[model samples]
Target: MINLFHFVLILTLIVVVISVAKIKDLLSAVILFAVYNLIMSLLWQQMRAPDVAITEAALGAGVTTVLLVAAISKTGRLEK
Candidate 1:
């Protein structure tokens, strides 16, 4: 069986990717990307890999989002 987490993860990934692609607003896209990372981290935990999940939760959901938001703020709100 694929399980609930796997199904949820796949669904979340699809939503995230679609949102990222369709959204014109940079901030919203970045936020969705962060959420995607969090979902992926949970999926990793479901697969029984604590270390990789921790790294993804920290790096992907934490640092990457901060950096991207900072970069976007610095650059400007308007997508250029």
Candidate 2:
């Protein structure tokens, strides 16, 4: 049986993925991508993969989000 916590995490991941794709603003999409990475990290941890979770949290949510945000700052936020 699927637990409520895992189900919620999975559901939130799906929502974030859709939001990232549907969002028009570059920064907003980056933020949503970071949120998606965070939820994925949590799910990985729940699956008993601490190393993968840590790597995803650090690289995906941390470095990648910062880099994307910086890129967006250099360019434009809107799609045009």
- Which prediction has the highest TM-score against the true structure? 2
List clashing residue pairs in candidate 2. Answer: none
The window of 10 residues in a row where model 1 has the poorest summed lDDT is 71-80
lDDT of candidate model 1 versus the reference = 0.90
Global local distance difference test of model 2: 0.94
What's the TM-score of each model vs. the native? 0.89, 0.96
Q: Write the per-residue lDDT of candidate 1 for residues 46-74, one digit (tens) a residue.
A: 88999999999999999999999999989
Give lDDT per model, in order: 0.90, 0.94
Give candidate 1's error at residue 40 in angstroms.
0.4
Off by over 4 Å in 2: none
CA-only RMSD, every prediction = 1.2, 0.8
Model 2 TM-score (2 dp): 0.96
Off by over 4 Å in 1: none
